[model samples]
Target: MSGRDYDHRRQMGGELIIPALAVCFTLYYFTTIWNSPWTAQVSAFSIGGILLLLCAAFFIKTALLLRSSEASLGLGGLVGIEDVRNGRLALVLATIGYVWLIEDLGFTLTTFLFIAISITALGHGKNVGRATATAAVMSLAGWAVFIWAFDTRFPRGWFETTMQGLMANG
Candidate 1:
């Protein structure tokens, strides 16, 4: 294909992707709001509104980038296409795995694994030790924040019996 054709195709693809993502985000936001509990309506509304705003920002950024002269050469010109493709695949896989494991592995363990896998897959392999340590720290911090600060009851898996006994005697 000619350079011009390739450029036009790239631009068109960007244009389509941004709008599609925006539409999906809009639908998701509305669906979440609609399905939210009555008691948590205000909280859900606030979160949904924030998500919608973020999605709008992403849409605007994508549009602006696509309109720029650099987009003619495609996103490959800005960021290596191979890296972007790999990163995107990693993100998709991590998201799917997180959803699948959320019930069986529980939120804490699944989130930890998800973070580690995502970081490793997104070209962060130079410091495996550091990445693992950081993932562990971050995961524990998240667990503490959600369990203590929010008073949320995250599933404790098969260890719940022992944990409950400790809590009861303490």
Candidate 2:
């Protein structure tokens, strides 16, 4: 790569969207934590500051590359998959399905389905048993940690209610 011609523009400029969104989210997080407790402020700043630094570095690197005509802000790399069936579109649709189904299905069930579907989609429909097992494990862990331990008010569907009753009884 060092000896190769450097004039070729990179097609992955669309990848920068995530870092840009991170910057915005960190700014919003900063605003929210300003009026909170000192501990919250410290934690928020600790993480958000690191995120900002990383985003700044990425922005500078991208700027240098763009200035040198080595990268273009084109969506082709992200959105131009020739085979739409097996590419990013499937992942996007899976995410949409997850979001659409989460409320009724609850976190554990929705997450299970999301992870299973996403793994199958990404793996091109292979690994059915492993994907199902992986999804079940991940969703149960998420439920145990986030829902049970932390007791977050994530929309309570049948699983959450049943678990709540079981824990209360036992």
Best by TM-score: 2
If candidate 2 were superposed on the true structure by all CA atoms, what would the RMSD be? 7.6
Give the Cα lDDT of each candidate: 0.66, 0.84
Per-residue error for 80 in candidate 1, Å, reads 9.6
> What lDDT tens digits, residue by residue, belong to model 1 across residues 1-170?
57775555444344445556766776776776686778757766776667677767866766676576434424443335665666876778789988888777766677778888788777546666766777788877876677545757886543333544666799
What is the number of backbone collisions in each predicted candidate, taken in the order shown? 0, 0
Candidate 1 clashing pairs, residues 3+ apart or interchain = none
The residue-by-residue lDDT of candidate 2 on 99-142, one tens digit each, is 89889989999999899988987888899899999999999999
TM-score of each candidate? 0.51, 0.54
RMSD of each: 8.9, 7.6
